[model samples]
Target: MDTTTWTLEQVKDRISKGQEIDERVVDIGQNTVVKFADNVSAEEGEATMFIARMTSVPVARIYAILRDESDGVTYIVQEKLRGEPLINHLPTLDTATRDALALELQKILNELATLDKGHMGLFGRPSQYGSGILAKFDPPVPPIESPEDFLRWLPHNVRDNYGRDEAPLPTGIFDFSRPPIFSHGDFVPENILIEDGHVTGIIDWAYAGWYPYFWNDYIARRRSTLMAFQDGKWSQMVGQMMQPFPEEFRAFQQLYYRADSLL
Candidate 1:
């Protein structure tokens, strides 16, 4: 269905009667899905368009982003890619296919990194949208001036409980000299789509942003820990897809553990 002409009210009414795909997403049709949120950010839709226009990386196309005036709900209409989440394909994937997928992921990650380091926040928006170890903010954190400022804003326990003086892993562990790069922000198996051993789509851009160069690698490794059923090999596969940052991963692990209670 061509949802290009969909209005907010029309989309809202359709969604009211659409089949729920999940809590926030609805299957308006085989070709379309809509995500609604009371506190929606334009970041996801903008990032989806940005990726489609700027790179060859496959992403779900956004048809419309509408906000209701009567109430504060926002709607994002997007293409529903014809593929299952990569997570579902893991159990059946052969060694050769897994390697091919890794190579594809590497190519995609390299393409995304080529995007200019505009600022340390959401694509086209300076405000931070937390991912990885940081908790999502209600009113997102304002544009950060420096990496140090970003670190300072992290939970005290997350930043300080590592050692003496409650210092973070190491002063220079995060090289602020390196500029932030465009990232998917979340690169777990669930966000990736695979069809016939080929990656068809990369969805969920809520955390997509310009982040520290190592952010993607770090987050992937950290997230793999939660996929206990993946046989603890997800991180290894993630390392194959991109350069692994052992030191950064170690540091983030400590931060993640300290902030685990709060999460």
Candidate 2:
């Protein structure tokens, strides 16, 4: 909260001087700017701050937090861990490692679900989510500036070389038919912290909310779990519980839509 734009080194100095950067200390995606600060002097992304306030509990208890306050916005900051996101484990971790991490994550998720129910959507919490992905993908905002261009890109982007060919997959975006519960709006390996075959922490609560069970389902069952989703047991359960949707969406949407990591 100073009058001039501060470099990362200068801001660190202010934080050290107790200038109110808060307890947040994560420097996520330091190499990239995930958002643009509007305060005329602030940096971008600030996922750190977004994660701090979203959860009712302290980050240390279960996860680290980050806060984005320079732009008059307040949120959590989480330090990036050493290992690759949990997604990396899918390709390499042994059974014990995978199970251990999954259970740990499941445990933490269950704890989150117990928080107050009513305030559980993006509207309820001004979490810095889509902003993060936007910052990461930097998708052309304003809907691609020209509708025609987006339409032009769509066909070639897929070119029949995309989506699932499987006949029966869960369809459409997730609906909130199920009761509201705590949810990691975008729970994926990338946002998780893993160490030595177990989940060390959860990060990026920007999408935390009380939403449809299937949304969480979609994320947990995503590309990272392509093997698991296709597993006979998991597939059969999906068929029993989910409604049908488009085949093209499997790669694009089904990954997260199928996972309901409710607990």
Q: For residues 1-263, what per-residue lDDT tens digits would candidate 1 score against the true structure?
A: 56568898788787888899889999988688998887666668888999999999999989998887787777899999889988887767888998889899999999998987677777776756555545444345655766555655555433344322333445567776777778898898889998998999999988888776678888788777674545755666787889888787787566555555454
Distance from true position, residue 244, model 1, in Å? 0.6
Q: Could you tell me the lDDT of residue 142 within candidate 2?
A: 28
Note the Cα lDDT for every prediction shown: 0.77, 0.40
Model 2 over residues 1-263: C-alpha lDDT tens digits? 22234354544443454323223432334321122123211211222233345543223221211234554533222234454466555556665666566566656666666666543234333222242222322222222212132222233223232332322223343332445555666766666766777566565555554444444555555533566434333333223333323342353352222221110
- In model 1, which regions exceed 4 Å deviation? 1-4, 132-142, 155-169, 227-230, 259-263
lDDT of 2: 0.40
Best by lDDT: 1
TM per candidate comes to: 0.86, 0.46
Residue 61 shift from truth in candidate 1, angstroms:
1.6
